[model samples]
Target: MIIVIDGLNKHLFGDVLDEVFKLRARVFEGRLGWEVNVVNGRERDQFDDLDPAHVVSIDDEGEVVSCMRLLQTTGPHMLADVFSSILDGEPPLRSTQIWEATRFCVDTSRLGQGRAKNSISYVTSEVMIGSFEYAQKAGVLDAVAVIDPVMNRVLKRSGNAPCDYLGTAKPMGKVTAMAALMDCSDERIASIREFAGIQHDVFLSEADALRLMAQRQEAKSPMPKPSVANQDHKPLSTLERYFVEQMRDARTESEVQDVLRLIESLSDTFTPEQKDALLNTPRAFAQEA
Candidate 1:
């Protein structure tokens, strides 16, 4: 199923966004050899900070299988700010009715090959259908996408090919990139749906999506047993308890250091041993427990 998230409701879908960015890092940076900013294994760019809408496809396991980023062309966008060379010095298209779609990718490595809805091919078309449907509802008239020749062919094969071309293709890292435009209309959406053999609504309820996400996370790694220290010792200080909880949830080295830094900010209150115990004991016991 697909989940459409915008800047306004992003706080309610943190886990979904995490998986989408990680998938982008895997596909665009790790696999495609693209030069992009990847922090903590997540591919993100300046446009992400601009609060663009995201169309994400989730599997039954609640994993994000495919995602596409959407941004309004009235402001700074890929074609206007980054890939302007493709326009050959002509003014970049700027209008509220037109939007820019970039960072379009699918997690093919995990989904593998098939014609099923969960398969890469089906999910790709599904994302396309979701994007067009979403834009049309928001009063967007057309969409301009920065894509490579490979993606252009994929769109053609999926029966959702671009309606027009902008500028000549230019070298972008290992692959050449060009701009393609497509109208946002029910006819285009219907064509993609017919091609993909999907006739039902492609969205999941927010509550159901969160439940599936929780299930996926639990299946990957079960939660550790609670710390016995809380039961044996007296109640902890607010700072110390917060520190220990952060340690329990820390998933990366950077996150661990962030917790340590927070503890250090309260150095006047916590003794060195107290700080050490908060950091070491919880994680060590979590593994053994």
Candidate 2:
């Protein structure tokens, strides 16, 4: 199941939490230099101890895969303290009803090996949708991402608000995009979940569900004039196989929906219920999402 844990409570700050930090350092500092907080192999900063963050997604055996930090609009955030230079003296962030989304990262190593019922991308989408729910419940209005312009466009095209260029979009570094939550409506939240197609706790709209179905159909349809050699023998990747494997073990409709989401991300196709019945069978790894 997609778990949502708020705050660095006592439980989260335990040994598993240490593992999460080490993993973060391994990926962000050791590999990407995306962070400078590592001092002798520990990954942490002031933000680590503060800010009510959300940890979402788990591995095949149930481990954290993806997470995001959110700060209430009432306080100072990275936008004000760290990224102030990027923002031209003043950002729209000061406006009421906006919480900053930061430290958004994924444990790439543990994802897509049938680790969770959903893939990494699927999990992240779920987190975003979950973030919206969190914001709605908390009465927050906007969710900001320190992301690239390209990612900003993707979010906008997928129905997010117009992004403010808080930072430059670099090939190997950070950028910023703030996504506003336009609708706190129950209908809107539900639509987000259904459209994303991931097994999330939030409610979803049927229209969003239908749109996802259409998008999947479009993704699966054959394109014109593709290379013949590339077309004929294109087998499913290891990740694709893993997704199908997860689908086989799904026990509930929500679980099935989660697996279908992973399939949609990979194959870009949504099969009918009749077809799905053929897909859902017992599998070797029966772990939760």
Candidate 3:
């Protein structure tokens, strides 16, 4: 399943990003021989400290297999700081709606090679789907990535090719890099889902995600007490649970408004107890990311 680790929920994921950084060390520093700093066997850079969103794909075993980092283009990003040569002296694109995707890598040794589960092809598409879907929901318009020719071809084959190239490819230390732009649109996201044969939501629900993290921890301890323990504290009906999951994934205020409107429309269909559960979801999600 895919888990999005942003500043809001990073504390809940329990070192999933740390494992992702180790994979990057193996792929970029060990295999690809990039000049990235590998401290304590984890490949990390300055951008990681900026609270960029980490879209992570984990195997059924709850180990991070494929992942990517996303940073708002309005601030410092890879294209502006590290891979500026790809822009050929032009100013990097800076906008609130644009995010730079970097440090994309997969655990080839663990996943092996094939289009089936636990393979590079499968996880690559899964992570792409998560990143695009998450960004689209967050009101992002576009994403930029600095990729090599091999990865460029992979994107083309996976039905997620870049719509535009910012500038000519330039030689990096070990590989040539080109800045490619992709739209965060439904068409783009649908094409990748079709290629990957994914017919359901890629993300795990909040409860399921926390369970996965708990499974991976050595202590296997329960999560911290929720901040809303003083709320209604009533058990949820199936219908109410569905709305809670929907609201959990809703990012923007406008999206939350749409969900609230839908719940209001079904007032006559739900029982009083069920309706109360649904309406009280705001307290459960009072600390929404």
Candidate 4:
């Protein structure tokens, strides 16, 4: 399933965004050899600080399989600020109806081949469908994507090829990059869905999303088991240990705030009765001698 994370709800999905960035670091920096900023295993750029909308495809286990970053063309975007060489002196396209899509990637190492929902082909199409649907609903008529030749071929194979090209391809680290434009319309989305054999809604419920995210975190770094000889040592529960680790790993004030917000959202995962029961549970108490 896919999850749309934008400025409005970003505060609620910090962990999701973190996972997206980590995946980007692996693909862009580690795999593609791009000269991108990677801090603590997260590939982030100035555009990320601009609060761009992220359309991410998540697996049943809550792992981010594919993702694309969307930014309005009316503001500072890649073609305008970073990849000006591609434009070759022509003015950058700026309009409210046009948006810029960048950082498109998929977890090729994890997703296998075939037309199944969890396969790379299916997840790629699902991400594209989510992006187009999201852009169209947000009043965007066109999307300009900064992608490589390989990605261009993938787009063409998926039946969502770009309607036009913006500029010549230029060397970008290990691969050449170019700009291509695609119309964000129902026809394009339908074509991708048809190609991928996706016949139902792709969005996951909020509760399911949260649970998946928690599971993803656990899968990424499981807690170590306590040793038998350490019976005298106090051990934290899994939840408490995870919370402490998150705080310890935080590098900035914003990250600390994100950790707090994620903790706050955990309250919504349970009902009032469950919350009451958890709070009213009996615990051992020491009596004064």
Candidate 5:
């Protein structure tokens, strides 16, 4: 399953974003030893604040196994901002039709080596398929990604060879970074899908995605009890209570995810404790039911 987190639906995916960051930390900092900003087990940079779209892949168990970031080239992005050095003094490519893709990674510990279910090859292709499909639908014509030689080979093997290269490969830390351009077109997507043996739509409905996300989150660690979640705990707002009640009244898993997304989206305006209470309401309902 795949879920896209953009500015519009980002609020519904705070937990998914959290896992994405951790996965980046594990791959970029831990394995690749790349020069990245990892704080408290999350890899992040200024580009994250620019509201880029994130294409994420989860397993049947609802665990976020892979993810990639997308930002319009017209705005502040990785290649234009932090990684402008890759241009080798040339100007960064900026256009509404072109988007930058970066921070592509998969959970190696959870996935195996072969191109099977829960395999690195499987999720990698799924992420590539999801990224191109997503960019194309968003009116984007191309995608620029900062990758190393290893990833370059993977792209070639998967039939997603870069159409062009922006600049020379430069050493970042222990590894080298090079900017590669790929087209977001039907032909390109079809080739990658065919290579990966993918024959179905690579998307999970927003409701189903949220539902899947909750399953993984609950499995990892239950939310802290509200009393100890924050010292200055505040009561839920009236509207917040309405959302929580709606979550309790939800009948199906789809409806549960929908109402939970609604409650979470509205939670940022309230206190931390209030948000916790809103999200934790579902568990409380399960207890009562």
Candidate 6:
């Protein structure tokens, strides 16, 4: 189940926000005992307010399935701040090319659920694609992710690898013990986007990529400059952020759907009756992520 809740600057505070928190508490604290505290039914942390986070995927029935927290190099980040040693002091970020990736997890119950369809790994691929597309949208030239040893293979299969600037990988003496930086290439990034099966292009469309360098140069000028003002820059709000975090703790599709209804309803940007329609609708099933 992957549901991306975008365009929410107008409804940041209200009961809708409260529902997000409730969803977090129900999933993270109630379903999974992963957090140290659950005050007032919201799972929060020091990093939540700082990073530019987004809730990309939710389980079927609208519960969060997998979420990621992305921090740009222009600001303080885990790699540059707490894990500076991991980069060997060169600073992994060189440009608007972002160094991101952290706090990635999927619903526990969904694990091993899709092993049969080859989509068993599809959810993880969606996260990878989302991250890549997000980086491209931000004008990022490079992306770096610190992943557990087992998942490192996943990234590797996706054509990402450790960078020299990323220092050394740590070993925990098990298949999942090591953590390494996964560096993606432009082509690989495109592949990631294509794999996700989304409609949007990342940096360049397939047709654009097929164009010769000279043709690309010719196509560059005389076009209306794209305006970024209409674009969204802020991270998810306190409420929306919590809904994403809850997915890491969701164990069932019903629970996930329960959260989704609240999200759609609370997105009060819709008409009252539209909200009613969203609430009154039956739950939809998502292929196991």
RMSD of each: 9.4, 15.3, 8.0, 6.3, 8.4, 16.8
Residue 251, model 5, lDDT = 70
Quantify all predictions' global Cα lDDT against the true fold. Answer: 0.81, 0.52, 0.80, 0.79, 0.80, 0.47
Best by lDDT: 1
Model 3 lDDT at residue 42: 95
Model 3, range 1-289, lDDT digits (tens) per residue?
8989988766445368789889999999899999999999999988888899999998777788889999999989999988887777899999999999999999888887868867789899999999998998889999999999999999999999999999799998889999999999999999998998887888987556645554555234333333352255554444444455456666887667766776777687578756665566554643421
Better of 2 and 3 by TM-score: 3
lDDT of 2 by residue, 151-183 (tens): 565455444443344544324344333332344
- The whole-model C-alpha lDDT of candidate 3 against the native structure comes to 0.80
Off by over 4 Å in 3: 218-289
List of clashing residue pairs for candidate 1: none
lDDT-best of 2 and 5: 5
- Residue-level lDDT tens digits of model 1 in 113-132: 87886688899988988899
lDDT of 3 at 88: 76
Model 3: residue 150 alpha-carbon error in angstroms: 0.4
**Model 5: per-residue Cα lDDT over 204-253, one tens digit each:** 98756755565554556534333333335444333443444455466788
Please give the range of 10 consecutive residues that has the lowest summed lDDT in model 4.
280-289
**Model 2 / residue 154 / CA error / Å:** 5.3
Which pairs, if any, clash in model 6? Answer: 1-58, 3-58, 58-65, 61-257, 63-256, 97-141, 114-120
In terms of lDDT, model 6 sits at 0.47
> What TM-score, to 2 decimals, does candidate 6 have?
0.52
Ten residues in sequence with the least summed lDDT for candidate 1: 229-238
Model 2 TM-score is 0.56
State residue 281's C-alpha deviation in candidate 4, in Å.
14
